[model samples]
Target: MAGAAPILETRDLTIRFGGHVAVDGVSCAFERGTLTAIVGPNGAGKTTYFNLISGQLRASAGAVLLKGAPITRLAAPARARLGLGRAFQLTNLFPNLNVLENVRLAVQARAGTGLDFLSMAARRRDLAARAEACLARVRLAERAHASAAALSHGDQRKLEVAILLALEPDIFMFDEPTAGMSVDEVPVILDLIEAIKREGDKTVLLVEHKMDVVRRLADRVIVLHNGALVADGEPAAVVASPIVQEAYLGIRTAP
Candidate 1:
């Protein structure tokens, strides 16, 4: 729908550390159930912007709003409780725990169940069933009992995704989701991400370096250069922008 109020928005969202302004007055919104990609060269403050919105980092100045309500004061866990889910650039997995245990624990926490793992482990059979469904969605059900450490790197990434799915958030944020996967593994992870968009209908914010992934999955693209929003438009137009081309995508001169 055109001109719909954003599901999430930042009002002059700014951040700084000493003299370095990491993100400078970035004001943008993600409409309901849209997948928006944040793309730029290293040091463009893409992840920092993500952190600010998701509550992993405090804004030096400005506000983060969810559905026209301010959430800048909310902490990371609080945001998660309010339907915000984040998957990090680095895999967040409990290596000593089995795949099922990892996801089940997230389900327990997301449910606001008490954190007495030792005492609650046996009684949370329902949580296990929920976790199984999450793993199945990510195609990790066959390795349900496999120790996270024993799984291949690609599977570990999938497990992390399963954990996020278990949280059942309304908004999903991903930071460099394919950063360390093998070439063969990239397509599988991308497929899962695409599936998440189609199946869950959740609002998505992604920080990704892969052009192919961004082009394929993003409904819109927001490009950053020097910690500021340089372009915001459809993928084809943004990628074709001379400003984006020169600053980040590299200008091409005809031979």
Candidate 2:
């Protein structure tokens, strides 16, 4: 799964909250154009690592590098400018707006264009096209005119993907993408993610609890336990590790 130069790297990344170390001196290289899934038991420092990489949480020590360049100092918004995009653990959407409108706003934001220009059709033509393309990519183009609130949970999840697509980021970090979807909705959202992974040559770092989703979409799996890396390698190999079975699957590693 790892190929080309690393798009992001953490050199002994560490963080501490008082006496608790949330993420220890962990070093990792996330390559470009691959999907890497991070999994573990609860409190495995999964989201914590995401915050550290995206600059949402400042590291107590160590650095984050993008394309071999240090970006550990950049704020989340600043990192977005450099092609790092994150879909929050919670859904962020404008319910009143139609599906297209929601993603169009993202497209405009990515261009750094002011909303005041939204009334100018000619000025918005390009943005409108780009937004539509994003919708198409996420398979929501047919519902472009529908109110966002009217969409099903699965569609809303896909809409969020469209919004992320509009950002045109090179690296995408997802925190629990299937969290709130219903059982049926889970497969739909998972399929959408798989489609995106298949269609693009983008780098994706995902934190997912659904073992089924992880098994299908991940090129590799990285396991975290007690705020430190416990496993990292191909999905099958890592998932079969006795340490992972003990920590997450409760299989209990032999004493």
lDDT of 1 by residue, 84-116 (tens): 888887777888989999999889888887556
Find the 10 residues in a row with the least total lDDT in model 2. Answer: 114-123
Tell me the lDDT of model 2 at 8. Answer: 88
RMSD, each candidate, Å?
2.3, 2.7
RMSD of 1: 2.3
Off by over 4 Å in 1: 1-4, 115-119, 252-255
What's each prediction's clash count? Answer: 0, 0
TM-score of each model, in listed order: 0.91, 0.87
Indicate the TM-score of model 1: 0.91
Q: How many backbone clashes does candidate 2 have?
A: 0
Q: Candidate 2's C-alpha lDDT?
A: 0.86
